[model samples]
Target: MAKHHLDPQYLDPNYEPVVNRSGNTPFGDILAARMQRRTIMKGSVGAALAGLMGAGLAGCGSDDDDDRASSSGVASTELGFKAVPVSTENRVVVPEGYSAVAFLPWGTPITGAYPEYRPDGTNSGEDQEQQVGMHHDGMHFFPIDLKAGGNSSSEGLLVMNHEYINQNALHATGPSYVNGLRPADEVRKEIAAHGVSVVHIKRDSAGVWDLVHGSPFNRRITGNTEMDIRGPLRGYHKLVTKFSPDATETRGTLNNCSMGPTPWGTYLAAEENWHGYFANKGASQPREQVRHGVGSESRYDWELADSGADAYVRFDITPGSGSAADDYRNEANTYGFMVEIDPFNPQSKPQKRTALGRFGHEGVIFAPVREGEPVVCYSGDDSRFEYIYKFVSSQPYYAATAGGYLLDEGTLYVARFNDDGSGDWLSLDLEDPDFAAKVQAAMGTTVGDIVFEGFENQADVLLNTRLAADIAGATPMDRPEWGAIDPNTGEVYFTLTNNSQRTEDQVNAANPVANNQTGHIIRWQEAGNDHAATGFQWDIFVFAGTQGTETVVDGEAVVTLDDDNIFNSPDGLWFDYNGRLWIQTDGSDDAPYQNNMMLAANPETREIKRFFVGPTGCEVTGVVSTPDVRTLFVNIQHPAGNWPDASDPRPRDATVIVTRDDGGIIGA
Candidate 1:
C-alpha cells in the first residue's frame, strides 16, 4: 500500500460536519435578501444619523451595486485579448498576441558561488542551499526602494514558496529505503529543497526580465535555517525541545504552500500538510498529535538516516527519559504557523506568528487597513471538514508604525455558520466562559476532563487549534484554499477546492453537491461592510465546471461556467492592481479541461474567461502582477507535463513571465 497520505483527516471516520446554510436555493437569492435587509435598515435609520456616518463610510459601498453588475461587469479598461482555448499538448498555451518566457527553474543559482543546475540530480546539499528551491507556489514582489511606489515595478525582490519536493527527481537513482532508512546526504538535500526563495530580478530596456545573479538581496531560506517562535505559544511547555531549550526558537520551515504579503514589506509563508513529514512510533501519541495526523511511519522516512546526527533524529518526535529539554518529543509543536520574513532585510529572522492559530494554513489575506482600526486577516484550514479563521489585532493599525509588530498581539476566532444564512466569529480564547461551554458541549466534557489532556491554557488553545475549533462548533469547509479581497470593495472570497469524499448524507447547504469534483468560490461581505465586524453575509460566487455541468439551486444556475473558461480544483487566487481576479488550478488534466489553467474573472459581473492553460501533468499556481499591471508572473509546479521544452531529458519546475505584445496592461 502507498504510505503517502495527501490529507490524513480524509481517512478519519469521526470528521466534523461542515456548516452550509443556502441548500437548494440559488446563492444569489440569499445575497439579494441580505442586501435588501441592509438597505431597509439604512432607510429606517434617521436621516441625521445617516449624515453623521457618511464621512466615515465614504468609500465603503453596499453590495447592491456589485450584485447588479456581476455578469456584464467590465474593467474601466476592458480586457480585449482573445481567450485561450483548452489544450492537451505538452506546452503552455496562452492567448493570441501574448508572449511567455520561462525563467528561474529549480536549481537556478541565486548566489554566484553555487554550481549551475545538473540535470542528472547530482547537486550536493550545499549547492541546493545556494540555488532556487523546488516546487514553486505562491509568491510576491517587493521593490528595493519602498518609496518608489508603482515606478519600482521593473525592479524588485521576487520571493516565492517552495512547497515540497519530488523524491525521484531530487536523487540520482531515486530515494533509497534500505531496511526502512534513508541516506543522510539525500535527506539533507531534500530538506534544502523545502521552504522559500528570495531573488533580485530586474526587467531590462528590451522588455525582458532576468535574475540579478550575486545580488545581495538574493537568498534561499531552507528547512535547516534558524527561525524564531513568536505569539501566544512561543515559550509554552508543549514547544520545549532539545533544539530550543528556552522554547523561543526553532529550525527551518517545512511544506511552505501559499503566501501573503504584508503592507510593511514582508512575506508570510503558510505551512501546509507538515504533519506527515514527522514520525512518532512511540507507545502512545498525544491527542493533539492524532488530531493533526502525525502518524507512526514517516512520510519521507528521514528519521532512519544512518548519520545519527540531531538534524536527522529530529524527525522522530518521540519522547525520551528526563525533560523535553533532553528529547525531540515536543519538536513537532514548533511548526504549522504563518512564518513572517522580511524580504528587504535578509538578516532578519523569520517569526512564526502563533496568534493566527495553526493547522494546514492555506494563506492569510488582510482586509483594508484604516488608521486606528483593528487589522483583520482571514485564513482557511486546508483539510477535509476544516474551519475558516479570522484574527483581529488587539491594537489598532497605524501605517506610520512598524508593520511586523501588528501580528504579535491578536485574538484568533473560528467561524460558525448557522442554518439561517448567518454566521458568528467565535473567539478561541480559553478565558471566554461561553466558548468553554460550547467546547464542553461538543466534546462532552469540561476542560478539567483528563480524557482531553492538552486544553490547559491559552497556549494549549493556540497549539491545538483544530481541537479548539471542533469544540467551539465552527463550521467545517470543503478544503478551503487561497483567499483574496477585492480592492474596490470589501468583499472576501475563498476557494473551496473539491471534496470527493463527501457522501449524500454528508452534504450541507453550502456544499450542496455530493462527491464534489469541480469546486466553487464563496464570497462574503462583513457586517456593516467592516473588516473587524464579527458577523457577515455570504453566498457562492462561482461554481467551477464545464458549461452544462453547473449545479442549480432553486431551478436557477448558481454561476455559469463554459468551454472557454472551464476549470477544477481552484487552488490559488489573487487580485491584480486593476482589480481583476486571477484564478489558478491544481487538478486532473482530463479531457474538456485538458490541463490545469489560469483564468481572468470580473467578480462584479461574475464573468470568467480562460486566460492561459498550463502543460500536461502540471499545476498552474502562484500568480502576481507588477505594480504597472503590464507584466505578470505564474509558476508551473511538478511538471510531468515536460513544459517549456519537451526535449529536455529531465523536466524542471519553473516560473514563466507573461506580457502583451502591445505593451498594454495584462488581460486588457
Candidate 2:
C-alpha cells in the first residue's frame, strides 16, 4: 500500500520499470508538475481510448474448458485481462466471487512461536531464519498425496522464494534510528531472511488456504544456511571460501528471486542481482567492473557504505590483508545458480546445480521429460541485453519424472543466436581453449588485486560468473527475464523485458531493434521439439504492445499484446496445469495503465487479456498454479515502492491464493 507517486520529470508518463532513484527531485515541485501532467494525460489517454477498438471482457473464473479445446487441437478462446478488484484500498483484488487468503507472510511462525507481526520491528536474526520472509516471489505447491509417493495428507508442501528485503516496510515505522546506521543487526537478519521457505499448506473445508504451523515440512533456507555445489564446476578450486573448506558447501543464498520446479518435484530458486552483495573494492575503476558483475548501480550498496563488521565485511569482496588463505573475497564465487532444494526432505542440504549455466537467473521452466532424452530447462537473465539460457541434462528423463539427482549431473549451455533463424547451445565446459584463455586472462588481475587478494583461486572465476560468461561468449539478449513452456506444444517462451540501455545501432539479428522500450516475448522450437537437441530454431512469437501500438510482428499474433489483454514488462511467467499461460508484469508501461497487472493467454490463439491488476504502484509477479487447475497462487511483490512514510506504505508484500468461487477449475 505504501508507494511513491510517479515522478514526471525523471520518468516518462508511460507504464515502465525505469524509475529515477536519484532522490534529487523536490517533492513539492513534483506534486505541482504532476497536477499539470494529469490534466494533459487524461485528455490524451481519453482521446486515444476513443480511437481504439473495444475488446469485450470475460468475467474471471475457471479455464477448464480451455483444456478440452487443446485436447481437440483447437485454439481456445483468446486470453484477456479484466481487472479483478478484490479490494479498493491497496490490496490483492480478484474477480467477483473468487477469493484469496495469505498463504504465508513475514514473521509468521514456521517451527517457532506464532507471533503476530509487530510494527515496532522487534524481530531478531535468530528468529528470522525460522520465520516467513518479505517479497514472496515464485512458488509451487507439491501435492504429496497425488503422486505415487507424494504426501498422503490433505496438507501439501509449499516451496516459495523469498526475494530481497524491503527494509522500509519491515517492522513498520521504517528505520530504527540506532545512531545513523540501519542497524547492522537488521541487515544481518535481512540476510538470513532471504532464501527459500518450505511450508506445509492446507486448504480447509472452507476452501481457504493457510499455513500449517509447526508442520514437519516447514523449513527455511537463509543467506547463511549451509549448502553444497555439484556439477562439472564443483570443487574445481573456484568455489573455495573461508567457510567452504571443501569449496563445495556454501554459506547461504541471497537475493533469491523467481524459481523453477523440477520434473521430479524439487524446487529451483534463482539468485538475481547477486553480484551487488559483494562490494569488491575499487569498483569506481573501470577495470573492477570487468572482473565482477557489480558496477555502479547495485541494490546492495550497503556494502559500499558499511564498515566491515558482523559479516558485512565478508561482502566487501575486496582484497584482504588476510590470506585468500585467510578471508572471504573469493567466497562470492559460489552464488548465482539454480539452487535445488527438496521440500519434502527436511534433512536434505540444498544443492546449487552448476550444470545449469548461471547469470541473473530469473526462473527455469521444465519441459515434459521424455525417456532417453535429456530433460530441458529454460532460464532468463534479468539484465538489459543479457541473455536467455537453457540447460539440457545429459541424462535422459523418464515419464512422470522428478529430478534432484539428474540436475546435479548435466551440461550447462548458454544460448547463441545465428544469422539464420536457427540457434545453437554453447557448452560452458572448460574444454574450449578460447573460452578458457579469455576467462583466465580476465581473471589474472582480479586474482592479483581484489576478489582473492591473498588467494584468488579458481573459485573466483566460478563465482564471478558474468565475467566467465563474457569469456565464454554467451549471447546477450534484450533484457531477458521470466520464461514459460507451452504445455501442449512443448515450445519455450521467454520475455525480453524493455531495455533502453541499448541503442538502435547496437541492435543485431538477435536483438534487431535499438532502444526497444516496448519489449517482446520470444519462442523457440527445439530440433524435433526434443529437449536434448543441441540445435533449435526460434521466432519472435509476439511483440507485447497495446493494441495499435507498433511492435515486433512475426506475421501472426502468436503472442501479441492488446487492450483485451494489454500488459507490459513481461516478467513472472508460469503455465498452469491446465495449459493457460499466466503473465505478470514488472515495470509496467506509461500512464492510463495505473498499475502493473496479471494476464492470462491461450497460447494456441495468441490472445491475451488482463486478468487482474494490483493496487497503486505494484508489479503483478510470481505465479504458480495448482495441478488440479483449481487454485492459482501468485505473489504480490514490493507493493510499496520507496515511499517516505513506511508506516503507511499501504500495499504490504504478500502471497495470494486465487480460486474460482464456483468450485470450477482455474484458467477455464
Candidate 3:
C-alpha cells in the first residue's frame, strides 16, 4: 500500500488502478445497518457490540488448549505485558521488561560460503542468492524436531517472505541504466532479492538465537527459482510460457508476502503485487493482463536488461507474432497463487497451488485441520475493493500423508457480506449450479477488455479470480489483508486496510468511513462452527483511527476510539496459542501513533493494547514465535533510518527477536 511520505526510492507496487466493477454492496453499508440497530442504547459501539455479539463471536470451541498443531498452548487470554507507548525514534521500543534484538537482516549470508553482510550494499547477485532477501513480511518458525514428529524449540527453520526490494538500498549508490536498459548484473541482483528465505536458526543454551550458516535447511527461493505449477489450473493453456511450454512449471516466485504453515510441515508463500513486476506491451491486452494492472512499464524494468537474456526478458510478458510457446505472454499468468515449499527438503521445488484462487494473495490462514475433514483455508486479495476467499479441499486431510497434492483439487469460494450481518460463500467452481447461473447472467457483460462470456471453464475462473468474484456479487472490501483464526473461539479476524478512494456514495456498513485512511478489523464465525459452512455471521471488530474519532450512525456514536488503543492500517493479524490476537500495523507515521506498531488483543473481551513500536519509516509486519511462546520474532521492513545499528547509515530490513527478561511466556 501507499505509506506516508514514501521514499522515492521505494515503489508501492500495490498502487494500481481500481479494477473492481462488482456493483455489489460495499462493506460500509452492511456496517451502517448493523450500527443502526446497536446504537439504540447510548453506550459506545465497542461496548454495545461486546454486549450483543460477544457470545456469538466466541464459538462453541473450548478455551485455549494444545489442540493447535503448530504453536503450544497459552497460559491465559489476557495480555500480560504492559502497553508500550508509540515512538518516532530510530530504534525498536518494547515493554519495559522485554528485550528486542535484530537478526537475519537483508543480505545476511546463510548458505554457500556464508558470505558476510556488506553494510555498503556491495553484495553481488551471487552473494545475495546465498543471503537473506530484502523486505521481510509474513514468516513462521518450524521447529527442526517437527520434521521427526517432535516439537523442539531450540532449533528450527525460520522461513519468511521477502515481499519486494528497494533498488536504491539494494545497490551501493543506485541502479545503472544505459540507454533505457538496466545492467544485467543489477537486474540479476534485484531478482535475487525478491522471494522467500529459509534460514536454519538455533538458540544457544543461554537462549540467544543465531543463524546456523551452511545448514542443509538453509536455502533461498528467489525470483529465479524454478517451481512446479500444481493444482486445477496446472497445465492450463494460459500458463504456457516460453519457459514452461507444457504449462507444468514456471520459473521463480516474485513479490512474496504473508505466508501460511501447513499441518504437514510445509511453508506457503503468497505472491502479492506481482503484476507490478511485468508489463504487457501489446496494443490490446487480454482480460488477465488488463484486470491485473499489467501496464506498458514494469516496476523494475527487468525485461529491459542490457543482456536481454531469456531469464530477464521474460518479465516483459508481451505477446509476439508467434504462438504462446514462442513468447512470454503467459508468464504473469503463472504467478498470483499460494506457493507451497517444504522447508525441511533443500532439494524440493516449490509448487504453486492454483486451487487456492489467485489474486494479490496477501496470505493464507488455514482453519484448524481435521483428520478426515476437508482442509479449509482463507486468503484476502489485498487490494482496494477486493474480496475475501476460502478454499475447501475436495479430498479429506490425513495428517500422516497430507501434502501439497491435497491443495491441488478444491472448491474455492468468495465471500458475500450481506447488509443484514449475514454472509454466504459463493463458490467459484464452474460445476456449481449457483455459480454457473451467475456466470451465465454476467456473460457478454464487459469490464474493460474482459468479456464475462470468456470465462467458460474452471481454469478460466481460477485464472481471472478477481473478475469471477465480481460476477459472483461478492462484497467489495477495503483492501482486505492478513487474516487469523482464533483457536479458542474458532472466530476468524481479518484486517481491512484503508480504502481512500471510496466516495461518500460508496460507503458501506463494514467500511463506514468515506475517506477511510485509517483501516479496521472485521471478524466472523462460520455457520455451525464449521469453516466449510456456506453461511457466516460477521461484524466490525475494531476501527483503527486517531483517538477521539467516532463512527457516527444516525447522530449516535457507534464506535469511539480511545487514546491508548488508537492505531492505523492493521495489516498483520495472528492468534497465538493462548488466543491473544496479535495485530501489526503498516501505515503512515503521522498520527496519534507516530510509527508502525504491533498490538496484542484479548479476542474474547475485545481489549487491545500496544505491545511493540517499530522504528521510523518502517512497517511492523510478519510475526511468529517459538512453540513455547516465550520468544517472539517480528519483522521491520524497509526502515528509512538506520535501525538495529545506528553505525550503518543504510537501513536494512530485519527480524527482531523479543523475549521477557524473566524468560516468561510472550504476551502471557
Candidate 4:
C-alpha cells in the first residue's frame, strides 16, 4: 500500500502544496539534539521520548494493563476506564462502561419555525438557513446560566463550526451544472452551511440530551450573516470590498475549524482553509492572496451562479473594470480571521478580530488569564510548512468589563524553534522599535526567497500575515493544527499533523521524520510560565505511528506506539479542567489505525490510551466535557456507511454524547 501522509482535512489533494521554501531548521534536528539513547525497547520510544521524560526517562510511564506505573514512582493518569480497541465498524465506540448516543445531527431545526430535517436532502436554501449545518468541527459548551454565576450542566448553548459541506450528501441528486453555471438556490444552500451554529441544548430529567426548539439563544450564523469588522485592520484599504466600501463590515465566516473560548466567556470561531472558497482569476494576484493559495479556481464554484447576484458574484475575485471598492476584488481579504461570538446574546453581531492576524487559523487556545495581566492566546496556521502564532492583548484583562474588545488591540508574534531545544517568539508588529530595527537591518538581505522590504504599516503586516512570518524568520512547521494548554502545567501543546512533502534534508527536532506519514505533537513551556513570554524550552511529546514501528531519521530515536495507544494525524486537542489532554485524529484510516479516534493522555506521566473510535471515512475532531466531567461531547465529521441510524442511508455528521453508565466522572 502507498504511504498516506497528507492530512484528510485538505479539501483538495492539490490544495495547500508545500509553500514554505524558507529552509528553516526542521524539527527533527531539535529532537535529535535533546535525545540520548538509553535502552533499546523493542518497538517503543528508545531514545527520542516525551519532553517531560527528561534526560533520564523519568515521566515516561507504561499504559499496559498489568504495569500501570512509571519509573518516577508517581501513579499513572487516573483514567478510570479500560482502553477500547480500534475499530473500522460503522459506529461510534466507547469504553465498555460508557454509553455513546448521537444527538443534534445535521439539519435538526432550532429556530425560525423549526424546519424538520429531510433525509433525502430536499431542504430548500431558506429551510437550511434555519437548520443545522454540515461537517461539524470545533465546538464549546457554554452553560446557559453562566451570566447568573452558575455553571449549569443540565442546560447550555452548544456552539460549533460547520467547517465545510459535502455536495453529494447536501443536494438530493447531488449538485447540477449547466454550461458551467450553477443554480443560485443551490449556491445559497451551500453558503448557508458554511459558518457557525449556536444551539440551545438540555439534558432532561430522563437524562436524554436533545436540542431546545425555538430557544431564544438558538440561531445560525451563516455565510450571508452581516458581521462587524473589528481591530487593527478594520477599515484598511485591502478590506474595502464592494459590499463594504467603508471596510467596517463583511458577510459570513467560512471554513471555520477548531474554536477558542475566551476568558471573558465569548466563543471564537477560527476561519481555516477559507482561501479555497474564492477564485482570483486575475493576471497577477497580490502577495497576500498568493501566499495563502487563493488561485484561479474555487472549491465550490459558487461564483458561477447563473443568477449573478451580488452575493454569488463576490466569490469570483477576478478584477472588474473598477476599483477594489467598486468590484468584488477584495472579497477574499475579508475572510481568514478569528470571529468572536457572544452565545449568550442572540442579538449581538459576530465580530472579526483582525488584530489576531489573517492566515489559515486551525484554532485558538488561550492561556490561563490573570486579573490584571494582558490576555494571551495562541493559534496555528494549518497548512504545510506554515507557522504558529500567539496574540497578547494591549489592555489588561478585567473580569468585570472584559469582552471581545480585548482582542481588538494586541501584538501578534510568530514562533522560531531552535536546534538547542530553545525557541523565541518574533514580534510581527512593525511599530515595535525592535521589530522595525530588524526589518531595516535586513532590507537588502534575502531570507527565504522574498526580499525583506519592511511592511507599509501594522495593518499591512497583518494583511500579509504569512508573508510577514516568512520575512520575520519564523520556524516553518509541519502543518500545525489544533492546540491545547495543560491547565495544570501551563505548557502549550500543538499537533503537527503529517507533512508528506517534507524532504530528507528538512528533518529537524520538532518534526524529526522526513516523509512524515504519521505526525507528532510538540510542546513548549513559556518563560516564567507567562503566555506573553518571548523565550521558552521545547521538546517532542509523542510521535504517532504503529506499534513497535521505528519512525526514525538516520537511526535517531523517535517514539513508538503500543497496542493500547496508537494513532495518526493528531488534530483536535483539548485539556479538561483536570488536565486530561484529549487528542483527536484526522488522518487516513489505512495508517495503522483503521479509523479516526480520540485518545486521553495524562500530561504528567506521559501515559496515553485510546478513548473513542469514530466510524469509517470520518475524522474524530472536536471535544468538550460537561462541568462535572460526567458527560463528554465529541464530533464525528463525514462518516461513511449508515451511522447514528443504521436504517438511514444518508449519513449525517453529528455530536456523540459519551456518558458513564454508572454516571461517574468521565476519564476519572
Question: 354-432 in candidate 3: lDDT tens per residue?
Answer: 9897799999999999899999999999888888999999999998889888898989999998766688999998889
Assess each prediction's global lDDT (C-alpha) against the native. 0.76, 0.61, 0.83, 0.82
| Top-down TM-score ranking | 3, 4, 1, 2
What are the per-residue Cα lDDT tens digits for candidate 4 across 146-199? 887788888999999999887777889777888878999999999998888999
Weakest ten-residue segment in model 4 by summed lDDT: 1-10
Count of clashes, each model: 4, 47, 12, 12
Ranking by lDDT: 3, 4, 1, 2
Best by lDDT: 3
TM-score of 2: 0.79
Structural similarity to truth (TM-score) of each candidate: 0.88, 0.79, 0.94, 0.92
> What lDDT score goes with residue 388 in model 3?
97
Better of 3 and 4 by lDDT: 3
Looking at candidate 3, what is the lDDT of residue 593? 77
List runs of model 1 lying over 4 Å from the truth: 1-74, 147-151, 178-180, 440-450, 507-513, 551-558
- Model 1 over residues 1-668: C-alpha lDDT tens digits? 22445322122222322322212222222333332211112111110111112222223444454442322354432456778888887778889899988889998999749678887889988889989999888998787676344448788989999988887777787777666667788888989988999999998999889988778888889898999999888889889999899899999898888989987778999998788788888998886677777878776777778788788799899888789999889878998899999987778999999989978898899888898998899998887667799999998988778486789788899876654556688899877888877656645443212245436788888888877876776766768889999877777889988777677865443344577667778777788888888897665667676555443333344345667887887889998876778999876677778788999987655667889888777888899988777789999888874556666566688998999888877887
Candidate 4 off by > 4 Å: 1-14, 33-77, 441-453, 507-513, 549-560
lDDT of 2 by residue, 1-668 (tens): 11233221112323223211112222112212212111112121100111011110111123465554533244334332244522224555666566766556566768666556554566676677778876677888788674566533346887888877666555445434334345566666777668888888887887777788678789889887788888755776655667765677777887777888787778899987676566556435322234334543334444433444735656655656765546665656677788988887898999988767556788888878766777778888776546667676767777555467677666566676653446777655565555556555655344322342221433443344444454455556656788887766677888877776655544433233455555666667777767667787665545555544422232221233344555556777777755678888776435535577777776655566667667556666788766556677787776654321245333356677777778756555
Candidate 4 TM-score over all chains jointly: 0.92
- For model 2, what is the alpha-carbon lDDT of residue 5? 39
Query: Which regions of candidate 3 are displaced past 4 Å?
Result: 1-14, 37-56, 59-75, 507-512, 549-560
